[model samples]
Target: MADLSINFAGIKAPNPFWLASAPPTDKAYNVIRAFEAGWGGVVWKTLGEDPAPVNVSSRYSAHYGKNREVMGFNNIELITDRSLEINLREITQVKKDWPDRAMIVSMMYPCEEESWAKVLPLVEATGADAIELNFGCPHGMPERGMGAAVGQVPEYVEMVTRWCKKYCSLPVIVKLTPNITDVRLPARAALNGGADAVSLINTINSITSLDLDNMVARPIVGGRSTHGGYCGSAVKPIALNMVAEIARDPATHGLPISGIGGISNWRDAAEFIALGSGSVQVCTAAMLHGFRIVEQMKDGLSRWMDEKGYASIEDFRGKAVANTTDWKYLDMNYQVIAQIDQDKCIQCGRCYIACEDTSHQSISQLIADNGARKYEVIKEECVGCNLCEITCPVEHCITMVPQASDKPYMNWTQDPRNPRAVAA
Candidate 1:
């Protein structure tokens, strides 16, 4: 079996699957339940100064797929509504009870250094392993100069991160917001402020749906609604791209990352690790499915690592970063065409319709003598766009087959068609 343990920025955990700071980690009861379910750790929900903010009822909304499966989740809920003293007492007890598990406290404070200076030591006194600056809450907190309000500004990100490092003895992990124009700017800023590691991406600002009858957006509050922080499976692609950018960035390269956003399964966790994440965080998945899902995640990752002959997470971490490159660097001479497997075809014309109507006219539909329908790929016209492959209803019904070519490897930067092609 492969060892799944990780020492993420010096905070040790039994595995990389940490429950992100959300409703699931809001209280000691939930955290203990998650630990019993085999989760490696938890970032205790975001805490603030005394007089916790009061959250409204109907704080959640969901985006559903054709089958009514939740594609994403939106929440206007703010940080922990419990008083700071109560949260701290629970954190102390939980850490003492579960000494082996990572206990990271997530916090959001006023921009003033005095505010952080006052609260940092109180949190540290809990014997927690680390502190995560909750700079990415996209909804309620930002209205009060916390969350994304601070995260969107790189200078504020650096300033607050510096304050945490200055006052707190535990490792500081800066949680970054995806709402920014350039995520790398804030990531580099975190590095400059002496952050031990960074985690991302926090929920996107979104409105999942609307009640047309009432003319209000989802999670309606008295016939009115406000946008909430969006997260879940739909945000995975966006999150992956941002993680890759930070992993390969020259300025912040090698900075530890705790990947977040839309990670639903073990494969999602593995993908994040391959792209340079030291560990992975989860919130939406745990909310959608219960905590027991971590069992499958752990089993699948361990089996896969054993199959790949990896002794530990570090062996394969960031292995894919070297191959992730700019579009201009991709080989332009590579060629592949779609091939339809007749035996596996269910005679579904989805591929044909999708290609003929919206994409290149590369799939040909034929009528057999007996009045049966058949679909075939027109190789000469196929652009290898994979539209037909994607639309095919059956698995492996259409595969992109690479063709033999004598041409040398060429990228857009060296091609003659480019306006700034280099001379060979």
Candidate 2:
């Protein structure tokens, strides 16, 4: 079997799939059950100072697809509502029992040297493998000058990370918020503060949808709602780009990453790993599908690794980072044409309508030799936009095939079409 084990910043785990610091890992009960279900690690729910914040009755909202499947999920839920002492006790015992599994504590505190100084040791006393600075909860916590409030400011992220480093002996992994304009700034700040690794992206601030009937946002409690953190499969593209940005940035290069965001399966986990995440974390997937979801992630990743001839996670980690680049560097002279297979077409006309009305008129509606309605690509008019390919309903029915380039290599800097071309 391919080795799924990862030693991220000295925190060892049987595999890279860990439960993110969410409700799924809130208490010993949930954490224990997750471990039994085969999750390699758990970043215990964000534990703040005593007197945890109260939660609203309806703390969640969701965006659904046509089939009523959740496309994205939003939550106004706060951190651990249990007492600090209770959390500490449970963490200590759980670590002792599951010594093989990685247990990292996620913490948030008031923006004070004393506040951080007070909590670091108490959490450290639990013998937890590591500590994650939870500066990325985007909702209720930010209002109190914690969570994303602390994360949005680079200086504060560096300062707080420094406090943890000074007061605690374990490795510090800074959990970052995605609400910032430039994610690299906070990532660089964490590195500057001597953080061992970084986990992202916390959550994006979003109001999923509003109830037209009541004219209120979703998860309305007593006729009110506030913007909550949005997450799930919809955020994967955003998260992937952010992770790739941090991974490829010169300043934070080689910095350990624990990727989190819309990671519902092994392929998602692999993509994060390929983009340079040392480990992957999960929350929404588990919350929706239960802890049992980790089983498929583990099995699928391991099987994929075996097929790819990768002996271990490290073998293919960061492999895709090299291929990620700015648009200016892309091959401008390259071209491809869309090919539609008539046999696979169900005569939906989705591609034809989409290409005709909105996109390039590359697809033409016509009759095939079999006397059936058909859609054909107008190769002359096709710009290789792939819009029709994406709009098509049948899988693989429309494909973009590379055509021989008749033009020599030329870029925007050299092209006559450029408004401001440099003197050759």
Tens digit of per-residue lDDT, candidate 1, span 181-265: 9999999999999999999999999999989887899998877899999999999999999999999999999999999989999
- TM-score for each model: 0.99, 0.97
Compared with the true structure, model 1 gives a TM-score of 0.99
Task: List candidate 1 segments past 4 Å from native.
Answer: none
- Expressed as tens digits, the lDDT of each residue in 26-76 for candidate 2 is 899999999999989999999987788899889999999988899899999
Off by over 4 Å in 2: 368-371, 406-409, 414-416, 419-424
How does candidate 1 score on lDDT? 0.95
Local error of candidate 1 at 59, Å? 0.8
Count: clashes, candidate 1 = 0
lDDT of each: 0.95, 0.93
> Considering only N, C-alpha and C atoms within 3 Å, which residue pairs clash in candidate 1?
none
Clashes of each: 0, 0
Candidate 1's error at 51, in angstroms? 1.0
